[model samples]
Target: MSYSKPRNDYINAVIIPGYTYDSKILVTQCPLEETVVDFWTMVYDHNSSIVVLLDQLNRKTPLWLGRQEVLQFKDFTIVQDNSPNPEELKLILSHKEKDPMSITVFTTSKVNNDAILPSNVLLDLLKKVTECWKIQKGPITVVCSDGCSKSGIFVALKLILEKMKIDDEIDVFQVVRTMQVRRPEFFTEFDQYEYCYRCIKEYLENDSVYANL
Candidate 1:
């Protein structure tokens, strides 16, 4: 549970282990209109500076990220910044008496919540996320609809990449098995699991991609 709304069982969220203190990913569902404030509160409480949205935004999402509206959510006041592309949005969040924080949002190419994004599309998302991690050293929050299917694939790959960067090797089965203990049904589909292996192989065999990881 986050510092914000500790007793409320509103938002479905969790913290997955990561390569660094600031590299952990908080997996969660897309917030409902009523839960939007809780979503930002969780982000603020976790010090998460980036949100990787893996599906199309629901009606409430836009109102929450309304352009030019400095909406106040509980103790936090959020302001939207310029979007570099149609798929991404940036926001500056001010938590009452605390310093303002930057929160960048990135989306996968697919619109369906449970869609198993293609390997190529996931690769592109990884590249974009690498850039976001460079800018913010806090935890990254990832959302789909339910938070465990596609988000699982993305988080698993993210951890694999982080390990590859430092160790140059990884055990695919061990990584997925361990994550499943904490997050049941992670990478729910068999195809997604195969895609993970395929992605790893692509990264290891390709010097250009390996260099970046």
Candidate 2:
């Protein structure tokens, strides 16, 4: 499904196929100024209930942030709830119960923007991501500065661990191989690819539940 307004190719986020059983994950770029509304529209249109942001947004700009400001644009009234961590805002779109959307913003550290997220940090993040999915479910939209660079790593981890949990074993290389076919350039960098391997090993080596998983 391609977007029509503002007309562009980047507006169409890639959907990683073969996930017919679980929540759909859409790899997309961090929303631009003109596409903020369109971004939300995509989320709503796809029935995506969770958005995982992994990039730093401009603080001063209203790209959809302020101490607390609600945004209203065509069929969506998004209310921002920011308290403890302003950077991690929880959004409620439209209703208070079913079909409302939730967003969590987080960005990992990188040197010269080339390094992958630290393995330790990534493991912890994966645990938290698992917890969130358990609670909310998804067609989770994972967005980063350039869209799928960091996001792809996270998705690969999730798919591997999830399969491990079910089958009691996993083949990381195979999982990533299939992923790259669905979305080109997934885990394309050597360091990032190595980081993913380390993250899975770290989880399997230490965690008891996932060790058996």
Error of 1 at 6 (Å): 11
Q: Where does candidate 1 clash, by residue pair?
A: none
Q: Rate the local accuracy (lDDT) of all candidates.
A: 0.76, 0.67
> Cα RMSD (Å) between model 2 and the true structure?
4.0
* Model 2 C-alpha lDDT per residue in residues 108-194, reported as the tens digit of each score: 443124456677766666665556666676577777768768888888887887777667787778878888887787877787777
| Among all candidates shown, the one with the greatest TM-score | 1
Q: Model 1, range 124-148, lDDT digits (tens) per residue?
A: 7878887768766788898887778
C-alpha root-mean-square deviation, each candidate: 2.7, 4.0
Clash pairs detected, candidate 2: none
Name the runs in model 2 displaced over 4 angstroms: 1-10, 17-20, 58-63, 86-88, 95-115, 208-213
Question: How many backbone overlaps does candidate 2 show?
Answer: 0
Relative to the unseen true structure, what is the C-alpha lDDT of residue 54 in candidate 2, on a scale of 0 to 100? 62
Against the true structure, what is each candidate's TM-score?
0.85, 0.79
Candidate No. with top lDDT: 1
